[model samples]
Target: MLFRVNWRVKVPSLYWTLMSFSTSHGAWKWADRLRIRRTTVDDYEGVVSVRSDINRGCDYIPGTYRQLLKHNTGYAGFIDHELVSFMFAAEIDNGCSVVIQSGRIKEEYEGRGIISAMKKHSFHDLSRTATRSVSVTSSPFACDILLQRNARLLCKMERLIFATSRHALKNTQRSPKVDQSSTIPADDAFLKNIFLSSEITSTIFPENRLVIRGTPYELVTSNIERILCLSDQILVSKDYGTGSANLISFGSTWRSNHTDVVFINLFGESVDDKIIFEHVHRHVAGKTSSCEDKIIMYIVCTKQQHEETVKRVLKKHSWELLVVHDLYAIEESYSWMN
Candidate 1:
C-alpha cells in the first residue's frame, strides 16, 4: 500500500465551517425564477458568456459544450432566461463511471445553494443510466461541498501551469529523450496492484465498486484519446491561433483554455517539473520566432506525490498554482441514493 500520509492541510476556519451552511435564502428567493434543464446546443453561447464573465483572465473558453450537449449529459441553471450555472459530466469506462467536466455559477449567484441543487438534480439524472460511480476534479469550494455531502476524497490534485515563452526558460533546460519504442506493457497487472493496494481505495464502501477494463497500456491510450478529444473542443471554442505539436510531451493534454494553455496528467518515477516546462518552451519557440502568449501546461498530482522538489521547480519557473483540487469518487452506481 502507498504510505498513508496526512497531506491534508488545515484550511481557514471559515472555509471549513461554511461547508455545512444551508443554501442561502437569496438562492431560494431566486429558485422560482431558476429553471434546471439538460443543456443543448442552443445554450452553448450563453454558457460560454457566463464562464468568461466570471472567470476573467483565468477563465478560458470551455471548448466542449457542443460535444457535451450531443454525446454526454449535463444540467444548466437558467434564471429569468439567463444561464447562471452550468454543470456537465461524461460517462467513461463503458458507463462504469462518470467524470464531471467544467462547472461554474455566476459570482453574484453563488452561495445560494445553486450548486447543491444542481448536483442533486444532475447526479439523480445520471444514476438512472448505467453509471456506477461519479468522479470530479474539484476546486477547494467544490471540495467543501463534497465533504459536506460525505463524499470520499480519493486524492488532492494540484494544478500548475507553465507559461511557455521563448524567454521564459533558460536554454539549459532540456528533457531526457523519451523512449518512443518502450510502450506501456501490454499487461495491466501494475494498475490492478496499484489500485487494490491503495489505502485510499480500501476506504471505499464494499457495496460501491469501480469497474475497470483493458491493460495498463490500453487504459493509458484510451485516457489520452479522451483528453485529445476534449482538447480539440477547446481549439474550436476559441481562436488562439495554432499551437506547437509537442505541447503535450508525455501523456495527452488534460485541459485546455486557449491555444496557448493546456494540461496533462503525467506519472513516472523520473518525471520532473523542469522537463515539463522545458518541453513546452522548446515546442512553442520551435513553432514561432517570438510568441507573446504565455504557453500554459497544467498537471494534476496527489498531495503525497506532490513533493517539495516538484514545488520548488515550479516556483523557480514562475508557474501559477491555479487550483488546489480534491478528487473524489462516489462509491455506488446510484450515488444519489446515499
Candidate 2:
C-alpha cells in the first residue's frame, strides 16, 4: 500500500530502485519501496519483531538489541512504515576498520534486494572515515555474496556449541586442577601487557585480531579497554618457565529463552597445549556452573588443528555437542580512499 508512487522522485542521499512488477497490460511497474534511515531506540520494537520473525523467536537479538544500538551504528529499512530489515556497524581499530554485524531481514521480504540496498547505504555512510570493513558469517549465501563484492577471506573458524545442564557437568568429570600462579587476574594493566605481548599475538591470535563474542577486534592499546568492558570474565594461563602467556580465553554470558548462554573465545599456542586448554575450559565451566543451571556454551577455534582439541575437551566434560559449523571472517578494503 506504500508503493503507490505515480511519479519518480528523489531525496537527498536516498534514491528509489525501480523493480519490474507485472501489470494487467504486462507493463513494467515500480512496486517495491524501501526507506532506510539511521535507527533509534524508538525502532526497538520493530527491530525485535523482525528479528524474532526471522529467527523464529529463538535468538540473542532481543536480549542484546539495546546493547548493540548503544555500542554501534544501526540502520533500519521500512516499507509502509513497517520495519523489515536492519544492520549494524561498529568502528574498530580507531576507525580504520568497521565490523558489520547483526544483519537481519524479515522472512516474508527475503530476495527483495533489501540487503543489497542496506549494504550500499551503510557502507556509503561508513566509507567516509573507514578504510576497510570486516564481517563474520556462517551462511554460504552470504559468503558467496561477499566474495562477489571482492571481499577477501581473512580466516575460517569452527563454531562449536555445547549444551548441558550444570548438574550434568558436575556429575561427569572431576574438576581439573589449575595452578594458582598461572591464573592471571582480570586487571587492566596485566591484561594489556599480556594481550599486547609479541609472543601471544604471533602465536594465539588469528591474523593478529581477537574475535571476542563473535566480533573481531584488532589487538591494540586503543581496543584493550573496550575489549575488557565487553567480556564478563577473562581466563589466562601463563607458561611459568618463560613468564609469558600461552593460553587466553574470554567468557560472556547472556540469557536466552530462560536459559543462560555462555560464549567463550579460546586462543592457545597450539593443539599440543591441550593440558592448559582443558584446565582453562574446566575453570570456566566451574565458574559458570556456580550461578547458572541451564547452560549453552559456545566455543570458537580459529585454527583447524585445534578443532579436535575443542571437541575432545568438551566430550571429556560430558558436554553435549549440539552443533558445529564453519565461521568465516571476511574483509573488504576500500581502494578509493587508498
Candidate 3:
C-alpha cells in the first residue's frame, strides 16, 4: 500500500451566524419590506435585476426566474417588491452543504442592511432544513457580507502559484516531460487498471482525473510538482517505464520503501495491475530519499481498464506494491483544491 498521510479540505468562504433581524410579515410592505421573508420565486425578476452579474454565471443563472426554483426548497428573501437575496440548500449522500450561492441588493437598497436581513433570514431557513454548511465562490461583495455575517472557515485553499516550503521539502514543484515516442499506448492492461480499481466512480469523472502517459527520462522537475499537486496516483507501465514517484502525500495510507516511487492514475476498464506495480517499484527502488513522499507520474484511463492497472500494480513483483484502493478520495484530495 502506497498510503502515507492525510489532509483536510478547506472551504474558503462561509458564515457561521448572522446578527439577528426581525422577520418579515404581511407581504411586500415597503415600510416593513426590508423585513419580508419569502422564497426567491416571489421576486424572481427583482432578484435577477439585483444580481445580474452573479446570476449570469450560475448553472441556473443567478436570477433566472426560479429556473433554480426547485433549488429554493429552503429560503429566498425579498425586500419590499424586489428579491434582494436567496440561498440554495441540498442534502445528498457523500456530504452536504448549503451555499448562499447568490445574494444582491439594488443600487438604492445598498446600505440599509437589506442584504444582511436576507442573509439572516436565509440562514435560519437553511438551518431549519437541516443544512449543516454552505459555500460561495464568486461575488466579492457577497464574500464581505458573508464574512461580516460571521462565516466560519470550513477551509481556505489558495492557488500556490509558487511552490510552498512543504512542497519544496518534498521536491514536487515541477512540470513533467513525456517524450512522444515513450508515450505508452493505452492498452487493454492499462485501461483495465484505471477503471476497475473502485477508486473511480465513472469514466469521465465529475472532477478531472489526470493520467499523464510518458517516460520517466522525459519527466522534468516541474513535472513532479504538477503530479504532486494534481493527480491521485502515478502509473509507470512496465513496458513503458521512465519516471519515479519522488514525494509522499500530505497524508498516506500506503507504504513504500522506494522514497521516490511512481504510482499510476488511470480511468479505464482493463486489468493486470501486477505488471504496472512491479514496474513502478523496480523503477522507484533506485532513488535515495527518506522523506517518504510518493511523488509520481499520473495516468488516467477508463472504468474497465482501471482494473488491469490495479491488478498489475498489486500483483507486481509478488505483491510488493500496496494498492491504494479508492481513487475518488485521491482525486478529491488535491484535485478539488485551488
Judging by TM-score against the true structure, name the best candidate: 2
Off by over 4 Å in 1: 1-22, 53-60, 67-71, 93-96, 130-145, 166-228, 231-259, 271-292, 303-338
Residue pairs in candidate 2 whose N, alpha carbon or C atoms collide under 3 angstroms: none
RMSD of 2: 9.1
**What shift in Å separates residue 153 of candidate 2 from its native position after superposition?**
1.4
Model 1, 1-338: lDDT tens digits are 11211225322211212222456556566656678998778777777765454222434335545664665576788888888877675556544555544567665675566665665566667755544445443335555665666665543444444454545533324434433332222123433433344442333212123311101111322343444334322110111243111112232221234344444443323334444434333333342333334555545443334444455666665454443433333333355444
lDDT of 3 by residue, 15-50 (tens): 111211223452223324665455545655554455
Question: In model 2, what is the error at residue 180, expressed in angstroms?
Answer: 3.7
TM-score-sorted candidate list, best first: 2, 1, 3
| Residue lDDT tens for model 2, 1-338 | 11211223321101111111112331211114788889888888887767443222236667777776777788888888888877887778877787767777765665566765676667778657787877776654456666776778777777777777767766654665545567564567866775668866887774777887657777777777768777777777767788676777777766666666767777867465455455445445554445467677777877766667877766776677776766777787775213
In model 1, where is the ten-residue run with the lowest total lDDT?
A: 211-220
CA lDDT, candidate 2, residue 216: 74
Provide the TM-score for each candidate, comma-separated: 0.60, 0.80, 0.33
lDDT of 2: 0.65
Q: Who is ahead in TM-score, 1 or 2?
A: 2
lDDT of 3 at 3: 37
- Runs in model 3 with CA error above 4 Å? 1-33, 40-43, 55-67, 74-76, 91-97, 129-131, 137-151, 157-338
Query: Which parts of model 2 are misplaced by more than 4 Å?
Result: 1-32, 53-58, 172-176, 194-196, 270-293, 335-338
